[model samples]
Target: MKENIHPDYQPVVFMDSTTGFKFLSGSTKKTQETVEWEDGNTYPLIRVEISSDSHPFYTGRQKFTQADGRVDRFNKKYGLADENAEK
Candidate 1:
């Protein structure tokens, strides 16, 4: 309820590098870079490495790990007959 107690919340553009997806929202984050948005106005540009547009879940590029070969490698190195023996 106090006047001038909160930081300024201005229009911000979050740019996703992988997909070139820009998200416009109100935030208090400060930035020195500016870019013209689709709204024909310049705002602080925040560059991000990953976003939903390029993420594995959304783009279907997820990776699966297989431990089947790891078990054999461990047994061969440690000379253990039972690979799943107690540590």
Candidate 2:
């Protein structure tokens, strides 16, 4: 309802610093940098430390430890009798 009171919401190009990946998005954040997009137009450029392009979670490079089941944990903690070993 107000004029010139709100920050400009415009298309911006966010670039991942690690992967050099660039994507177009809209934001109100200010930046002095600019980049020519694929469409041959200039847009504000914002560099980010982490993005989906290089994130371990998004790229499936995350390491996860397999949790031991209840029986396995109990056996390791109190030593279960090894029936197969005896046979």
Specify the highest-TM-score model's number: 1
Clash count of each predicted structure: 0, 0
Residue-wise C-alpha lDDT for candidate 1, range 7-87, written one tens digit per residue: 999999999997899999889999999999987999999998999888999899998876669877887788878746776
Off by over 4 Å in 2: 63-87
Write out the backbone clash pairs for model 1: none
| Weakest ten-residue segment in model 2 by summed lDDT | 78-87
RMSD to the native, candidate 2? 5.8
TM-score of every model versus the real structure: 0.70, 0.68
Residues 1-87, candidate 2, lDDT per residue (tens digit)? 988899889999999999999999999999999999999999999999999999998999997765977777787789886576554
Task: List the global CA lDDT of all models.
Answer: 0.89, 0.93
